[model samples]
Target chain A: MILVIGGAASGKLDYVKSLGYSDSSISDGFIGEEPVVYNLQALVAKDPEKAPGYYDELVGKEIVICDEVGSGIIPATREMRDAREATGRLCNRLAISADSVIRLVSGIPVKIK
Target chain B: MDFLLTGGAACGKSTYAEKLVLGFPKPRFYVAAMRPYGEESFIRIKRHRKMRAEKGFETIEKQTDVDEIELPPHSTVLLECICNLVDNVMFDDQGNMYDVTDRIISEVLTLKSRAENLIVVTNDVGSEYSDYSAGVKAYVQAIGDINIALAQSFENVYELVCGIPVVLKGELR
Candidate 1:
């Protein structure tokens, strides 16, 4: 699977569209049969440990966009910390197995892998 | 020469910066900007030492006022995590509440002049949507502005993600 990761509002959606992913091919995470999933943090936050299995169920032929929530200061609440930690772990896993990994910074996409 | 290495928390920027320093000459200096103030910081400082253990780095703890620091000639220096230093300087016990970006940058340039290569590690902490306090917002603005200014000064800039380096301003050496 291709992983497009960036911070919130960093234009992951636009980059995916630039890659020729049409609107019909994009879904919000585990809701549609679309090949591209955006805002994947919502899914991973549910169960970060199981996120790898969930992504694997996509058959490794999909494109996923995950917002990076791990670069800022330590969160105030335990729940927020858990969520960010989960996102970090899941993103690392996806990056390792991704066919290509791209990080978007203010709308510019940098190929990382 | 100056290089700025940036990334989010646990993104391997420190490890990569260490590798870059290793590629430079001896008398490598690691100017740790994080102060050993609280429990969390103490743990972090120890962990950082463990990360750079046996790596031949003469670590110097300069939690604030880096502009006054002087370094040996022909040495490679790494200033790890500049955001902490900004906090120590801006939000001190005296609470002067002044923007110290220009002074900090000038001091950093002074240190740069003393070293052969200065590699700095900063954070990408400007995208959160939640409303923070006036001080937190000001701190964020300060660091964000400082990153932009430093990027202009540094010859090479890199951002790390998932232990991988993405060239930002210049080609990786």
Candidate 2:
């Protein structure tokens, strides 16, 4: 699996597409059931009970993309804060197993793994 | 070695900080500044941090007056998230507001001098441009100024991207 993470407008999707994965192959992590998963952050935020290990199913099989959270002012609400912190913790296991890890900064793809 | 680690929320600053400290000798100290307020939030955040909880280290809570913290010589220290410390010191026990930049910087420096490796994890809250109130604006500015000053003092500085350390000042060990 390939893990792609960056802030908003970092061109994560474009970088993934540049790797030859079609839009059809990519799935919305919140709704779609496709092979490549995007928005893993939202999916985890939607369900606070789900752990990072929950994504173990995608190991070596899906392309994951998410927006980096938790860097700014702590959220005003409790729910939002929990979701923000959960995004990083829940993805730890998947990050370790990812075949390739990419971070998009200013629309430029920087390979971390 | 002193490190100033800056990264977006949940970009794995604590995880990376732990990795850096684990490389050093024993007697690791985790200086956390988060003050528990919301029960639900605490439980949820606790669940998230469980991964790092059991790691070999001693936990210390230094919400304010960090200069008062004392540690054994040659120990490694990881102070997770300065945003909380700034908030704590700014709003005292009576919830009064004041400028805490210089006090925080000086106190943190004092704390750094006591450790062999001081890995300070801080947030990057200056990116979003919003019409925040005077108090919010002041808080954000204080954090930014502290980050800039600390980055200059720390030997190694990094901004984590997706949990990966991106060198901003010195080379990774």
Highest-TM-score candidate: 2
**Candidate 1, superposed: residue stretches over 4 Å from native:** A9-40, A43-64, A71-74, A89-97, A104-110, B37-39, B94-96
Q: Cα lDDT of all candidates, in order? A: 0.80, 0.80
lDDT by residue for model 2 over B86-114, one digit each (tens)? 97878767767898899999988998988
Candidate 2 per-residue lDDT, tens place, A1-113, comes to 88888777889999888889888988776535677788877788787667455566667456888877766677777678778877876555667788878888899988887
lDDT of 1 by residue, B1-173 (tens): 78998877766678788889999888898998886766656766887799789989999888877767777778899998778778777876776687888877887777777889999999988756768888888888888888999999989999878667888888887
Instruction: List the candidates' TM-scores in order.
Output: 0.78, 0.87
Error of 1 at B46 (Å): 3.4
Please give the DockQ score of every candidate, comma-separated.
0.39, 0.53
Give the CA lDDT, 0 to 100, for residue A38 in model 1.
82
Return the TM-scores of chain A for each candidate in numbered order.
0.87, 0.88
